[model samples]
Target: MPSGLYRCIYYSKNRIDGGRTRIASEIESILAAARRNNPPLLVTGALVFNRGLFAQVLEGPCPSVEKVFEKILRDPRHGDVQVLGFEAARERMFSNWSMAFLGQSREDQNLFGHIGPQTGFSTERIEGDRLLDIVRNLAFEEEARAA
Candidate 1:
């Protein structure tokens, strides 16, 4: 019997620069696969750094998603990837998203800061920003970096 799959979305922040971008480079291939019409386990996510903080959102199967996240945190650039608030979705939120997302904000750092700690990192590592603003800024910065 196959285990059930889930869609999990959470964000984390770290006190570092270029870390998110470097992670981005590493995930370029995975991201491309995620952008496909449909992929197995449907894993996709991103990480974005701003003001000495790196924020990210990941979505996919529970086990596979967790595995990918573990690999990301071990990347030396990531630290304390605390869960902001993840839901076991009936399906994918962004059919176009996979692995990890970069440059997004926590939106409610205070709320996220209350979720306790995971992997020795506290919710205190959260960032405050509007979701739209974070995504937009991240898109711009990523483009500039590529140029």
Candidate 2:
């Protein structure tokens, strides 16, 4: 019954701007806000942050996803907001979480290894199929952890 599925990946500057503590708190605040807001909009997503870089995929109603992403673009805590992917999806890849976060967890490291190092927010090196595979893997891993 959903209208559309919107997904996006982006990276931003964190270390040069706020360092570890600041970024940690920022992530917490992001999760808090998402928990409070995403359900209302039926938004769900997965995020991975490492070494001052962030790669996130948001899925849900097109309007809600775009609105949330616009807010992210305007947020001052992060800079160099470069979007890696933006397109319509057939279904939600992360339906369980309003915002599922993957920090430097073992699973995260594994994923990074598989996807290879992504410099900046550039998606030039990551194939679309591979990106979706990574997202799917992270989604399942996160869900298992929650269980």
Candidate 3:
């Protein structure tokens, strides 16, 4: 049921109270390399400034995903960016998106159809409850901090 060759959960946290400028700098650095890779990447989920971490799901071809992570791991801005946890996804949560760039927002601005109700992620074999649980938990933490 899975693409097998590719799937990864990008779990990372910045130094506590790194602030938006710090986070943005990190993102910009990653994007610089991501743009070069020219790979199909969908940022299905994100936990920005959540519990002092910047976590997300980056799904695509295995090579591209690995390359992205390698770049991130090597980036100076990714100070203390730790890979917390993850699993092999059955399919892609954000399949439709060729590339997904995200920031902290709650308005459900889904670039890929997979993120919103239109794609029906459950039908695609993704565990909807689990996915949402992670997002919600992180959102609660991030929103509280932002507030």
TM-score of each: 0.48, 0.78, 0.51
Highest lDDT scorer: 2
Clashing pairs in 2: none
| lDDT of candidate 2 over 1-147, digit per residue (tens) | 445777876656553355566667778888898899888988898777765556678888789989898997887767777676788877877777888887546523544553466521244455545666666776677668879
Sort all candidates by TM-score, best to worst: 2, 3, 1
> lDDT per residue, candidate 1, 69-147, as tens digits?
6665665544555555454655543444443344334432432222335322242543332332354455556556759
Q: Please report how far candidate 1 places residue 69 from its true position, in Å.
A: 1.3
lDDT of 2 at 143: 69
Global fold similarity of model 2 (TM-score): 0.78
Clashes of each: 16, 0, 0
Candidate lDDT values, in order: 0.49, 0.71, 0.49
